[model samples]
Target: MESNVSELVERLGSDEDAVRKMAVFKLQGSIGDPSFADIFIAEGGLARLRYLTLHASGNTLAYSLTSFARLLEVDKGWDIIDQEVIQRVVELIVTHPLVNILRGAMSILVSIVSHPYTGNNLSQGKDFGFPALKPAVAVYPQFLEMLVNRLSSADHALCANALQLINSLMRESIANESDMQWPKFIQKLQDLGVIRAVYSLMQETALQDHMHPLIEFQSLTKVLLRKWRGIPLDLENPEHRRALKGIHLASLHERRSQDICIGTGTGTPNSKKHNPMKWRRLGFETESPIMQFEHTGFLGMMDLADYVRNHQDEFQKMLLEQSGKSGHQCCPIARASLSVTLILYEHFEVDKSEMDDSKSYLLLESRSNLDKLFEPLILHWTRLHIAGLHAFFRLWKATGAESEDYERIVELVRILIESVVGGAVRTKDVQEVEEEMASFEYSRLRGLQMELLELTYEDVWGQHLMQMREELYHEALQFIKEQRIRCLLQGAWFPSETSLNLGLGYEKVSWTYAQLSHNRRYLHFGGFDAIKKGRPELDALPEKIDLSLVSSVVSNVSASNDPLLPNEKDIPPASYTKITIHGHLYPVSTTGDTQKNDGQNGTLSKSAQEVVLLSLHPPSPSVASEWLDGLLMLLNQQPITAKTNKLLNLVSNYGLKIRLLNVRFNDVAFTAEAPPVPPRDDLDNDYYYDVFGGT
Candidate 1:
């Protein structure tokens, strides 16, 4: 039946315009999940989508049509609109002819799925295979085929979005009513060939084996097969009753079906069949299988002999170790017999007796008593006892629920991780780490602790912490800059429009602050004026202000060599006055906008320079006294080159650039510095140059 629909869809692509529309209309109206737009994009997708969108009467058909390029452009109004329909119809539109007809598919999906307004109320009482609000189920086989076929296409978001849609479609049914009709779905699933397809997909590496449900599928199959024995395969037919004989595997040839279809990646997923699972029944214990062990008599006798041989020495050691011991201290010979006193609690410990006494005759008869007898063995082999508690802690974090004890442990773990990872503590974990201080060796745990914490963070905490760290740095920089601004005021300073980034009224205030500060040493007025008027003898000054601490990385820039040489006075100061500070220069004109102060070229662009707050001047003394007392608040932020950079590399967080730009200095002694030069323009106007790829 579905084959006819497939054949018609292929015909629509090559058929006459009128015939194409009819075929498309039927498919779109029937199955709203138009995923074929991906295929059309594969070769001459652009041309095809253009044809579809221009001819379309409305966005109805084009809405479902989307390719990776225009996925995010999808809108809500067009979301329910079947895209393939629109694609076929759009060939008629003359304007925007090249526009991908599949455009806005993502926008449509995101808008409808995440809409705060009309979303939830509109999606109700719809049955398309999976009880999902998804319109894809009516053509589930087609949708699945499209997805599997498009797996190799360059677009990842396409697959992601498709999966998201499928999950959304199946979400409610699988979660709420899984138990009610799961088995029946499984039955229908086998009949429609989904089980065989899924099994084949499971075997293929292309399917995500690590997906959360894949493990559950394997477990479910084992349980189902175990329960199949003695249970009738079909309750209605007497001849259908048969005991399970082999592993519960799905296969095209293995299934008992009326019309057996060959397995392909795409199989019908549509089924209103009630789930076979009983949620309330809970676990494999609900239905135990009747196993027919032909060699059970021989195996049981062999197991007794093997067990005696393996444990003969272990029993002797226990007798010698506990020659006179008794009670809880008897070295627990019951299960696995290993016990350790709880270090922190002093008295409360893992109750071994609980394991031994936990056995129940019916449901708990098999696996239950083994825990008691092998408790020591598990502790030795699995580290199960302590690990179980930590696992509980992890669950607490994941679920967003916390008890006082869990919360306290979390806080402690956070502190320990922060101190170590931030490099506050240097020594690696060479010693055992204690939870409390004094007993806690900060340095010893710092190295080992971060490694442990890294694993914890890789899951959930790391991503969250990284986001929080960025926010904190921005905040910290703001506070530091505010203090830097306070120091930027004093006695004398040069005004560089392009130099210090003072915008609006802030620059004037900063100028005023620099002019009136009490401690001075804020702002520079060098280059032209720094040269002694008539004396060449006193004009001598050092070359580079080599403050090694100013930066750690090798740079082309050296500290300012202020005041032009006595010989350089012969050169006239141009329209712009520039003073090189740190490694860069600050420039401002009595004219327009400024640009980056390149070494040879000082050409100022009108847009490059901006204004700083017209902040008040700091306290003044007019000499290097203030500088001697306190260091100039210089901002030297290099790109994130280390792991630390991983947390702070954002365009919004680029504070170092801003800090380096806004510097203030008073007239200070200089050796010999050249006056500012005209900036050379770049040959290529289209090319953009940036240090960190513009972050």
Candidate 2:
């Protein structure tokens, strides 16, 4: 094998072109074997291959690049490849017209930038072998421009390769100190029209079928814009701001229309008119046929918000599909689109007082669309829920507390708090609960909660807070108690009984408290006003039922229909607020009942088996359904209803974090002095944190 490889290497210097091509082809095939590859490189094969890439053309050049890429896969290859060969490879990637040559060159470039030892060392400023190569590919302005230009290529394969190479370059750059090279690299790419070109590619109907690469490219562009350290365009400058707001350059026809005017002396339009100095003063040139800004960077020439608005339908569909998944299955396109939209909105829509009619209108339309898209899905999806809360906070700040939208946003926040608290009750695992409390979603939720508490300092929003004060306080208390209790269900309750004179009169109804233990061992009730006041003694609740004797739980109508009982019409048939528990009555005393039951060997006399009924009512239909499902789940019944099962799953998965969020909300909302805000989660270091900063 060694002798044969030596012969191939010798043929590369042959006089005939056919023999050299054949030799390169045979060498390309043998390079995959490690032993053969080492021998070929030792025999000066790498230098010869690099020479072929620059001097050869078509298949010969492509074959040489492919062989070079294969040699790069070996361990010793990077030690020998020089900076000139890498620079020539980048040139081939940009200048080559054929897809085959571009593809092979791109693969080689990706390998060089992605190699573990050399790539890592280069980014950290420690040179293993390729010191100059990093600047040749990543830092050089012309090289960055060449990569951005290939992004607009019509060939999908070439375009994808370009995107991959650019992404690799960014990854390498991010490892450096504060990504020091990123700002200049990103600025140069923007100057070369990369952002606009990428935006156009995303919207092209021809590229719709090949959108994975486009989506990744768009995502990378978003990251660069967000972390670029300084503003890319000056919003303080009127001309720059106007350009960012998407003022179109006037075409020659429009300029001509402005130039012509109807002369008062005649009933016909004049063929020519004096150039108006006013037009020039208004930033439109009268003498020049074209109108454009002095600074022509892409950031100044494009409206990112308008781009998002144009693709609103596509984004809506992606979000809808993603929100419907059972887990946090994020759609990269949707997340990237939303993140870019958010960054743009945060930067441009800062102060309403500074906005003109056009800017205000654009901001309002964008806000309205996002509100519609996120409102219905937030409660169902965790990531969208976080996003919805973020948008709501922005809306609240922009609209002020006096606007009607302010009240609506407050109501949404209140509902979200309740949902999160309710979900927290279902979590039982200590480790899982700890993990959730430490999550990114938890930090954001807590931040919003603190914001809401701050609103309580004002009279108008404080009234809304007062309305839910009792409820919020009660929930917070329950969350504290539930940490050790493992409560399955707990809420306000009303008990009703049959009367001899008045038929099923609820006129005597009084508010009471009820709780079902997680172990399904007992149902406890009593302490009404005390519990509402956030003070309750669980063991001293005054009434308890052994669930072992309970037979069934029912809703809506009465549990008994005997003639002696009150007529159904007398109570008007309790609908959404009704619950009935039926069980057998034991002859033993309520005290020491457990011991008495155990002495009876879990059996009861026939006379002691008489049916007993207990009727109760909750505050709402949803509460009644919750009680029904909790009871049914404890019974180990199969085929649970979908609605009940969904509620169960939500509580078990998201309940603990939400409860902690509510507790924090209440702590801030009720305190006299504002509490220190919780620290924001360190998202830059969390590997599981969403790229868009979701949970």
Candidate 3:
């Protein structure tokens, strides 16, 4: 065997191309045998393979990668490699046009990354056999970009390979047990769009099969949730740095103890601290799979995994519904749909021990005699968990309880509502309701509230339920109020529209309702029309004011009481107020229509380029301060970037071109003038000459 391996290695350097190909092919065949692998590496086979990777093409390049990657089975192989070699391999995997070569390169990466020692050394902040692979942070950007690109491939094998590669990368990175690198890895995934791209895989039909890809997806998600649940490290802050260092030292000591021989260890004073295996469990005693699943909400993920494995048709329908019928109840199929949702929430950390209590608490709260009938299923249902809550509600509704159970059911419903509202905490784990999950949460909560209202409508003992409903309403109202105030204080108000005018009272238009909203590029005030026309519709379309055109938002102003209109210089003191936008001053006053602006009324000129003042009168001085502060905060947003302005300008020109084409096609008016451009300091710049691809 030794003589044969030597002959093969020597042929790899043959003068003829055919001999070289046969020699490389034979070496590839010997890579699986550890003895043959050892001999090949010991005889400087790696240097020759590395040379081929740099200079060879096509099948020769593929065979070289295959033989070289398999030889990395030994620790001695990692010792001899460098960053240039690893980078060359990754570049080949990323840039190679042929699918077979890409697959071969990806397989090599998956094998080496799966090795336990690779992860162990990387996590300890030691060399990963190469400088590029050492930090992980430095090379992750390119690595993640290439991985995300492959996820969009239509070929099943290619997509599976990409998913498996991602799974291996995350597993090795997380296994390092080092707290400092953990959060950084997760953050990099987020920054480079890899996390979001991976999430898009949930909708992919081909990748959801009961294969290695699915298992890898589930495991990668679990590791992500665990990292999110842990405290973040801030190296800039001294106190945070100290905490991270303490955690690092503790983890290091734990790793060392696990390596020590068992029972040979002394019954030391710090036995608990020294026993790394014991501390690793973090108080989770049993080795039961269910208990293990409970820690990471893995059970919910398993439920989803089962659905994807055994019920492909049902899963496809659920995906379609999530895309088209978002915010509507998942009726008729609510049970099946909620099962998948349960998995998503579990993986996302919406269901946790801290927020959830046992179902025994629910049983103790209910006083109905019919409780025995529901007890069996109720026992299996988890409370304060979103999926369990929705499932139990649907089941109870479907069961058609007796009339006597109404009061008790109403009480239970009250308990559910309060639990959901009270349990809401500022957690990164509880994912915000996106377009898909919208119907699963708030809408269901509203349904529960309505159920309570209907049950308590007219019964003698219903007074308590009615009061609870009222309290819940007030709680909801207060929540919205607080959220609004918080948005105001935080300066992150959602872009919105409001009715307004210039407050300069015109003859035909005593009041004009206008809409307002702000984006990064401009402060827009549009939707202008007459108030007395009684239609409550805008007479003219809205327009946007570029932020670059505006100077400031101010309140100190004097205005004229002219009914027709007033110029900026004609306004007098004490009888009027106004706001200045883009050097255009318009008077402000309360509108007579008490229904709008919280009963505060006024209107100025409805003409273009005028400041539209919002007349809001709160019920109290504090409310007034909140309204003012919120407005000021919204107005104080940072200046728009040049890139954003350029985009807005291009979009504006495209719309103009579209409207011009429409007019020409209809022959409505070939002479119709284009709308005047808004005044801007940078309007003279050549920013939009390429709107039609190019001039």
What TM-score, over all chains together, does every model reach? 0.20, 0.36, 0.36
Task: Summarize candidate 3's per-residue lDDT along 383-448 as a digit string, tens digits.
Answer: 224443343344434433333333333344344434443343322122331211223454465456
- Expressed as tens digits, the lDDT of each residue in 1-695 for candidate 2 is 77887788888766777887888888778787888888987887766676787788878887887787778766546754556677787677655678778877886787777676546555655442223456555635366677778787878777777777776766566545544555565556567776556655544445543344554454444444334322344556565556433322221222332222222122123335544421222122342312232222233233222333454443344333433332212222322223323433243222223225234335544422322111111112223233434444343333332222343444444434343423443212323333343332534654555555446434565665454554554454343333213324544444333322364444533455777754658888773432256534567578877787776776652232223223545433233345677776553446424222445578543334435455665544445545655565565442133444454444442443353345444333232566587676874664564322234
* Candidate 2 displacement at residue 636 in angstroms: 38
Which RMSD does model 1 reach against the true structure? 29.9
As for lDDT, the candidate ahead, 2 or 3, is: 2
Candidate 3 overall lDDT versus native? 0.45
As a whole number from 0 to 100, the lDDT of residue 281 in candidate 3 is 23
Please write out the lDDT profile of model 1 over residues 1-695, one tens digit for every residue: 34555564464565476665665555444332334433333333344334554444344344324322233232212332343432222222212222233223422343333333235434852222233323433433344344333223344444334334333323333444434554454454345543433333333333332232332343333333323222333324332212122211111122321111112112233433432321101111122222222212212212222322444443344333433332222222211111111111111122222223333222334432322222111111112222222333333333333222343333433444334222312122212122222233433443444445545655666666567556767765445433333433322333334323323333221221122123332332222233234422212321222232131222111222233323333332211212223321234344533435555776544443333312211122222222212233333443222222333343233443233223233222234575686466765576654432342
Where is the poorest 10-residue window by lDDT in model 3?
A: 372-381
The runs of at least 3 residues in candidate 1 whose Cα sits more than 4 Å from the true structure, single-residue gaps closed, are: 1-140, 176-695
Cα lDDT, model 1, residue 86: 26
| lDDT, candidates in the order shown | 0.32, 0.50, 0.45
